[model samples]
Target: MTGIAAPGTKVAVTGAAGFIGSHLVEALLGRGCEVVGIDRRSLRSQTLARLHLGDVLDHPRFSWVEGDLTDLNLNEVVDGCMYVFHLAAVPGVRSSWTGFEDYIASNVVATERLLRACREAGTPKLVFASSSSVYGMVDTLSAENDVAMPVSPYGVTKLAGEQICLAYAKRPDSRLSVTALRYFTVYGPRQRPDMAIARILAAALTGEQYTIFGDGTERREFTYVDDVVEATIAAAGVDVPAAVINIGGGSSVSMIDVIGLAREVTGNPVPLTAVPAQPGDVRATAANLSMARLLLGYQPRTDLRTGMTRHAGWMRGLTPHLLRTYAPPPMITGPKEATCSH
Candidate 1:
């Protein structure tokens, strides 16, 4: 309650302990709104524990509800909230390869449940966290109305979530003014370590040999966490009708270039070992953000080089944790070394 205003609008943030969600919580607090944060995992370390505990320590206004959105009493949490940022889910394309049912439950079914609850509570607006993976290596850059061809179950679930939100919008009693922000390769501080650029760069910075899947040729637009968060906030503030906007970094760059940039920033000469491209991986993704520009006034400000520099700097600050997967450094030798080993 301390973070939320006494009489101010209440904003509920799902996945509050997550990278983007935590930052969004801080931003909402900065804006003088009361924040109700919910997350599924308990903190394993003191630092992370404080992220959830310190700001709202014994505060009357801030509320911490520890539960899963799929199982929670949604009405109890969202009852009076003016805005809801649905950021919770089992994330990662590789992750879905093993546990598709988890993705279905968390990303699809859970989202539907939340929408239903929003309808019941007469909630005004919701900002959904979606992925640009829905584009799936399209022949042209994805537009707002393109047929979403999700290559991965994870992407499928996210698209399904958006469709579910849209379906709810069509309902007579559905008062939820929802918007979906299709985020393109978000990176920055607190990035999930499994993500491509961050995970590899993190290992390289720390003198660990990181693995690169496939040749570092696939191009992607890596959006910074701040830019993505800003776009989400912009979507929340705007009156756009059932909008779906692309939030990418200003431009696209190849994985090879990103590796080079990370090496320049970290000054660490970690070795590289190329692996096969994981299933569900897209060759390239470029967002046609004209709709976002016209609707949310969202212009991705960070470029790949700047974003990687910032990401390397952030990873350098963290005390290295044991990464679940092994990573190799960027290969500068030749394109042959960088090609898929599989």
Candidate 2:
């Protein structure tokens, strides 16, 4: 029940077609593990077009189930699985302000249901993908002990999701050992088109203007996707009783600086359009990774310039039309100026 599930052991990953989930699925398959990838989007879905998992999907050790987490038959998915990595949740902070109910359903209610199902199925361990936004605007590098005061509904629901896992762990008869990883801003190739890095790179490549809210001073501890995947896999295998760990890139960079790095990396000067700061947006985020290192032996390998360079390369390989098709609508800056980037 502890230590990395042995090779050939079935592991279930929700959101398997997502940016991070797809990468995790590939890593698990490479480790000689049997994987069940559960995702709401099918292989044909436009959202998954960038995933590029033809070989992994064809592998004998990988199976996929497309269904909603809220109504999916968890018994069937969790049956005989050694570990469950729950990465399926509605994402985006700006969108959550108006779509709070969807966030609750996906992040909070679905998490509760998944935990209950894991308990019933006798699943031993679960690694939930929590967010660093749960810490809001921290004065120092955020730690697990800090009182969680999420400023946005997205962060609030992620905090609730973590609490649900902890609540289940506290049950007298429960066998589930939950490890919630509070991930800082995860970015790399295949990052959601809505994220800052993705949008910045796309704009740079396509000659489109990229919007920057908050005067380009906002900073984030941008963890690479591969690093997050490593920590997540380590968390699933480690014999931790029940813990919340911070998984971050270990370096904080300002938004304007990131754009400079992107220009240096891609050799494409990205046009910038600055707008008023959006609501629920924090000014800075830096993760205290002492716990992640101590607990999961996690250390981020990719630095900001290197990660951004890789992301730029990946974006360059994509068809121009796909980039335009998947580009997320401009983020809401404020009520006065509903939209900015075009």
Candidate 3:
């Protein structure tokens, strides 16, 4: 159960075209892994050129499967793989309330299908990209053993996916070693256009109004993307039968403070619009990372300011067309880890 993605290690990643997924693919490739990726989105060459994964297209060991998870020939995507990272899902909290069916299909059904594929392929390690949304509103730092009382349909679906993983891991006939990391507000360069930090940064560039849902006091444990990716890869190698770990950003901050940091990092002021908080939006989220430290040897390396500085640099590198993809959000942001399935 201890494999650190050595040279020529065969790995499979779902949602390879997404923000976090793309980063994971690159990290695996850097480790000399032979990677097979599957995503529902068709990655055109030109579009790929505009995103984080353009160079991966030409790598000798990299291949991609472009199709929905439920319909794809999953054995092609997963067979012979030593590790399978399941990161694909329809993200966002409010949207899930309006489009619960899509959430169920992608997060729940698609996950079940991937689990079955891994079971049949006899994949050694399955790392599931879960979320803090599964915790819902918490009065203190949420830990792995806390009762899951998700307040959003999206959270419910994510919880269902984690439950399914736990069930499969406990099954008598299963050979899967499961590690589900509950990511708390993952952010950095290449964040989805819909996420809070992405919008907050984009608003600085576009001069558009960045909506602040609720007062600006809503706090989130914003773990950097690189930190999350490392924790995930580490989990794949860690010796554990089945475990859930929290990947936190190392610190917590309010939305207002984040906005201020964005302005400081970019040196550009963004107009802010305050609005009443919508349903399913938690007042705050924090993580107790004792398990992460002990289980995966995880410590969040990037703080908000440094991570935001890198994010600003990334945004500055994008062309106007590329920047268009980082369009201002209609609302402020979604749940923590309102990501993946990019």
Over 1-342, each residue of candidate 1 has an lDDT whose tens digit, in order, gives 111233467988898887788878777776777889888867555355454345554555667888888899999889988889999978877556666788898888989988888888888889999988777757567787888888877788888999898888777666788888898888876676556676667667656666766788987778888788878877876574487888887676787777788778778754667777777777887788888787777777777667778877766665545332224435433322222100
Per-residue accuracy of model 2 over 133-161 as CA lDDT, tens digit each:
88877778898999999887788999999
> Which 10 consecutive residues of model 2 have the lowest summed lDDT?
333-342
Error of 3 at 249 (Å): 0.9
User: Per-residue lDDT tens digits of candidate 3, residues 112-133?
Assistant: 9989888888898899999999
Model 1 residue runs over 4 Å out of place are 1-7, 44-61, 320-342
Give candidate 1's root-mean-square deviation (CA, Å): 5.2
Q: How far is each candidate from the true structure, as Cα RMSD in Å? A: 5.2, 3.0, 2.7
What's the C-alpha lDDT at position 219 in model 2?
84
| Candidate that beats the other on lDDT, 1 or 3, i.e. the better one | 3
TM-score of each: 0.88, 0.94, 0.95
The TM-score of candidate 1 is 0.88
Candidate 3 C-alpha error for residue 142, in Å: 0.6
